[model samples]
Target: MNAIFLMLMGLGAMALGYFVYSKFICEKIFKVDPHFRTPAHEMQDGIDYVPTNKYILWGHHFTSVAGAAPIIGPAIAVIWGWVPAFLWVVFGTIFFAGVHDAGAIWASARNKAKSIGSLTGDIVGNRARSIFMIVIFLVLLMVNAVFAVVISGQLINFPSATLPVWGAIIVALIIGQLIYRKIIGLLLVTIIGVVALYAMIYAGPMIPLALPDSIAGFSARQSWIVILFAYAAIASLLPVWMLLQPRDYINGIQLFIGLILVYGAVLISGPEIVAPAFNNELPEGTPSMIPLLFVTIACGAISGFHGLVSSGTTSKQLDKEPDVRFVGYFGAVGEGSLALAAIIAATAGFASLADWQAIYHSFGQGGVSAFINGGANILQQGIGLDTVLAQTLLTVMVVLFAGTTMDTGLRLQRYIFQEWGHIYNVGWMQKAAPATFLAVGSCLLLAFGAGGDGAGGMLIWPLFGTTNQLLAGLTLLVITVMLVKKRRPMWYTLGPLIFLLVMTTLALLTQLKSFYDKGDWFLFTLDLVVLAAAILVSLECTATLTKQIKANKASPATDQP
Candidate 1:
């Protein structure tokens, strides 16, 4: 089969979902109240709460939620073949991810732009809010750890990526000063930034900046990890407009160009689909598709992390409540489109059937790396680019994705710490400097101390998928709670929520056997804690649902905002 067919099919489905199904959702379910004043206008702080153009906010939200996870997920998941991963990416985004993301934004916007953590109290109870907040902390911890490892790995292992990665940051800073200071139109800045980013990709190999084996006695990887966290610390501490929003705008442009490049390659090259529709032969320790596929492909298909970005940050920056549909739903479709690009590159962009199989065979070392190699092949074969430069281009893209995600994760973690301190009345913990240290310190410990020699960030990666999916399940449950509060029918959110809960729970349960067999008590214990947290959050969600149903039965429906 020609790869173009699958690419067009995926794009067609997304367009249909956006126009048809997403319209039904907007009209019947999350009715937008244009008359309502948004928090961005009400609380115009010009920092976190400033009103932003829908396009710009959409860029910010999409870039942050995307990162490397979507690429990493579907890139690895094609191990099951393109069929399952492709199907999930299509329907899953249309129904689950788009709804969850839009619902999160709507739910938070309706409640004075509160974080989803704060909105939990209104549905479950006040205490459940605290519980979910702690869950957010864990989510942030995993994010920071995983991305730090990913970026450093790119720096150390793929030295060609380093120049383009850091070069884009400098480019973003220039664009920031130009646009934010009103020196140039955003359209002109965007064009220049995108071109400059690609230029850097071409220029990257000319000045590869690989770290040495020892930096003040630390190993290269270890030294890179410390440097990454330091960069994340400063990025997180800075105001949104200063660095993050501007940088993400540049990334937002890169992502679309990437989609064009990868998909454009499909149209040009028309590579054959040699990988099976569903590979039944199981590799040792490879997860069954039953629950693992869903977890592995969270960001593109469905993710709880989107909820935090939507409610915690995006809601506070909305220019209008009506724009929620565009920013939230379209942002999700944008992510799914990116995932589709990855699926195409992995399944159809391979040099040969034997080459694809060889890459998947070394899954541990190159699951993520395959995307870089395959993407390079696509660029080389279709776009007439040099193979080495093409490889460097993708490596830099991945590093940039990971870098932005790391910055956003640390920022969210800092928010959780400050929120925890204020809600619990811990005076000293409310300060940004202390909270930044503590937040970065914990991630450091997880990435280094407990990770020991593996201190590269793999310590938490084994079950990070399960925990992240659990967070997605919880996010959907929270969306359900928000709907019920408004006397809205919630089958759309409820169905996906239940499905995610079951799959993630089952995935964790299945993984425990290996944890025990390996005598890895550390992971074994952590798994149990996450499992318990899922159970508790589910109970709270269930209780809220029951109470809502009973109240409606006993009296007339009391509609809420």
Candidate 2:
């Protein structure tokens, strides 16, 4: 297929899903009542359950939904060609992600401001609640660790790109704070901020702070992991308004602009999709397409991680009843569209199928920088631009995308640590200082481990997919339990849960085989860690369901007395 056809197909699929399937079918079946008194309305707390405006909530929800996972997963999925990735993303978002995200918001709203963890306890049982918390905590840890490495690698690969993106973030935060909170002039602040950000982009190469020969040996990828951890530590401790919120606002704008540029390029160049549809065989020693494709494109289609963000943060800030559908369900569709855009962009650029295969073989696993440079060179040839500068800018854009996600991950880790400490009655963790320190320490350990090899290649990538899918499976389980409790038709939740369990379990087994085959003791060890966690969580969930069933049966008789 050509780029134009693919783009049209993608947008059509999204529009059909979002407007028709989501609005007419799912809403009618699920009976989503916007006027129902949500938790934010019933229990109005300024801190957590405050009702927010739709526009501001959109900013928050979109930022949280769009993260590094979406980019990386789709990028990897395209290795199998844009066809599978594109189909999964479009269909998955329509059926699974939209449902999951919307369900999280609805569940939270019904539960009177309780988080997903707390809701699990009330509906699934206390045991399942504990298990859910542990799963989420580990998921956040892995997320923070992986993203830190991703950003650090980008920074090192393209120093020229880093300065402007970073500068944009810094400027955005200051301007956002001054305009929104400090009551400064919004129009002037925005204008000045945009101009400054653009200026930094042009001036980035002229800046003098290049990596030294000795430090440069650290490898751009490895250094990023450390830098990511350090940045996370600070971000976790700051007031959300000061850093996290404002920074995301800025990053959101950049994301918008970057995406527009990419789409414009696609339209201008009209590159054909050169990757084959179902090339005769899979990559060497690969698993069959059935489970692997689903597993590979986990984030693009339907991510359980989205549930965590929805229930943990976004749901908490939902100010009104109607906003739930837009921010939760629609936001997911937006993310799916972004992933689709990436898949199209990657597949569409090459001159011919042979050229595409050659490029993929040479630099596919080298990371995003290589892909961007390769794509930039293609664009330079076809569309006359300074190849070096375009590639540098592309690198910076990728890094900034990864960096924003890392910041969110770090903040989440702090919350997870604090909550875990509180649940266990750990005195030290009850204090902010101790919790922050613990979060930082945990991230640092992962960073160091990920960076152990000089190349930082193939070290963290393998772990990211399995752990991510497992988290998604766990999220589905929680959502299923909630659906059952709400007395919705059980099939909606049961069907997806069963499908996810099979896919994720198979994916984990695949990882185990690969680990054993490679004889890499460290990865083998990590595999064992993940397997144990999965088993424990499953048992906890089973036990909780059994108890709930028995309780429901006994309740009717006791009421007769």
Candidate 3:
């Protein structure tokens, strides 16, 4: 099969999702009121709650939700064959991710921009909220810690990407100043930022830099991890408009360009689908593809993390209530498109079946590294760009996205800490500096304390997919309850909620056994905690649903905003 078929099919599905399906949900289901005052306007704090243009807010939401998971997940899951991964990315985005993301933002905005975790208290119950918040924190912890290791590894591996990756930050700072300070027009600044970014990409191969192993007595990777966390702490502390918004907005544009390069290359070259549609010959220890495939491709299809981002940060910045359809749903579409690109690059970028097999000899093999190498090859062959420069371009794309996500995740984690502070009546934890310190401190502990290497974040990575999907199911449950209370059609969110919960529960059971047998008691215990939380939250949501249904039956439907 030609890669163009997958490209056309995926892109076409997402277009219909945006144009047709999203319209139905936005108008009929969400009933987005144009006149509705959003938290961004109601609060109007310059720090985190400034009203933003839909486009810029969309950029921030998309990039923060994206991270490297979309790339990493599909890149690895293609091991099950591109057919399964491709199907999941396309239909999952249309049916699952789009609604979940858009619904999350709508739910949060309607409720005064509360994080999904906090919203659970009012809609579900305080008990459920406590459990839900823990799950959210664990997810954020996994994200911040793992992404730091991911970026560190990429920087160490692709030294050429180092300059462009860090240079983009400086470019973003200037763009933020220019845009927010009204120093220049959005168009000219966008043009300038992107040009500067690409110029750095072009110059990256000319001056590749690598740190020595003994930097501050830590290995280069460890040192990079420390540096990245430091940067994230600072970025999280800064005002969203000062760095987060502009950085993500520009990087979102850069990713679109990067996607065009790869997709355009596919159209021009028509690469063969070298990998099998279904792999009958499994790697020795590959898990069954049933539940694993769903979790492995979580971000591209549906992610609980998206709900956190939607409610945590994006909802607070929405300029209009109706923008949820675009910023929330389209953001999922954007990540799904990136996942599709990863699928194409991974399965089709190789020269032959045997060569692809060499790369996929293991389940976890062929992730970010595979995507970069294969994507660079496609660019070089199809567009005649220098392979080195192409690699730098793709590398910088991954690094910038992951870096932005880390910034957002850490910030969200800080919010979680402050929320906890309020719950426990701890004054210092509510402070920005102290909460940020706790967030960074916990991630650092997970990194250095658990695994001891710079890769400690990988310690809990195996559980991220299951835990994340479980949280997504719980988030949808919250949204479903809101819809039920409103007397709106909720089959869209409820169906995916049920599906995700089932798959995630099954996956958790499988992992529980796997961990127990391997004697990895630490992860086994953590898995148990997550599994228990999933069960508890599900019960609370069910109870809340029943109560809402009974109340609706007893009285006339009272519509809510």
Candidate 4:
């Protein structure tokens, strides 16, 4: 099959999802009211809760939730076949991801922009919230630690991306100031920011930068990790408008441009997909595609992390209730598009089936590297651009996406701490500076202490997929509960909720055996803990939902908020 055919089909599905399905959800199901004042206005603080333009908020939400997972997951999952990955990305975005993301924001905004962790208590019970928060914290910790490592490694491998990657930060700071001060219109700001960023991209190869081979006894990767965390801590401290919002906004625009280049290249070059649509000859040690595929393509299809981002930061910035459909659902569509592009690049960029086979000989072998090389080739072949420049563009795009996610992850971690303070009455933890310190410190400890080489985050990464999906299931459960309480159509949220829970539970059980068989006691215990938490939270939610449903059936007028 030609890549353009797949691209058009995938893009068309997502477009229908955004315009048709999402509208039904927003109107008939969620009943989003444009007049509804969101938490951004109700608790308008200049720091975390500020009324933001839907476009800017969408950029922040999209880029923050995107990170590198959509790229990495689909790129790697093609080991199964591009067909499965593509179908899941397209349909999952329409049904699962869009609904969950938009629903999370709606639920959060209705409840004062509470993080999903905190809102569990109100909807389910205190015990559920406590357990859910543990999973949420673990997810955040893994995201922060792993993204730092990812950016660090990418920088080292693609030195030409360094100048543009870091230089874009300065551009963001300037753009932030302009946006916040109302000194310039968003259009002009976007034009200026993107132009300056591209100029830096053009100059990047000429002024590539790298850390010393050893910094204070740390290798270059380790040194880069430390520096990244330091930048995240400071970014977390700054107000959202000052750095986070504008940075994400610009990065989101830049990523869209990158996507257009890759997608357009596919349309023009019309590369034939050399890999089989469905591979009967499986790689050695390949897990069953059933549960693994769902967990593997978490972000591109449906992700628990997207819930964290939606409720954590995005909800707080939503200007009105109706914007959730745009900022949350459309943001998800954007990610699905990226994942589709990744599937195309990884499958079609190679010249022949043998070449594609060589790259997918094993799972995890092909990831962002595959996307970069394959995408660079497509860009060169289709547009006649320099291969080196194309690589630099894609590499910088990945780095920026990861960087924006880390920024939001760190800030969300701080919010977690503040929520803990409110719950436990620990006054000190409520302060932003102290909370940020703890957030950064915990990630650093995990990175350096768990693994001396600064790859410690990888130790917990195997659990990330299942754990992330588990959380997504839980998030959908929360949204379903909200829908039931309001007498809204619950099937939209409930259907995906049931599917995710079943799949995630199966994945968790499968991993439990894998971890125990390997005699990895630490991960085994942690997995056991997470599985137990999932069960506990599920039970709590089920119990609460049962009561809500029974009460509704018993008394039509009895509504519990």
Candidate 1 lDDT, 436-540, residue by residue in tens: 899999899888866554364677677877888888788788888777767877898899989999999998898787799899898898888888888887898
Error of 3 at 393 (Å): 0.9
Local accuracy of candidate 4 as per-residue lDDT tens digits, 262-298: 9889878989999889888888988899999999999
Q: lDDT of each structure?
A: 0.83, 0.66, 0.94, 0.92
- TM per prediction: 0.96, 0.87, 0.99, 0.98
Candidate 1 — worst ten consecutive residues by lDDT sum?
A: 362-371
| Residue range 346-450, candidate 2, lDDT tens digits | 666556776666655631342354347555754565557577666765666566656666666665666677777778888777776677778778766766654
Which candidate model has the greater TM-score, 2 or 4?
4
TM-score order, best first, reads 3, 4, 1, 2
lDDT of 3 by residue, 418-495 (tens): 999998999999999999999999999988876766788999999999999999999999999999999887798999
Clashes of each: 1, 3, 0, 0
The lDDT-based order of candidates, best leading, equals: 3, 4, 1, 2
Among these predictions, the greatest TM-score belongs to 3
Candidate that scores best on lDDT: 3
- Off by more than 4 A, model 3: none
The model with the greater TM-score, 3 or 4, is 3
As for candidate 2, its clashing pairs are 51-319, 52-319, 152-224
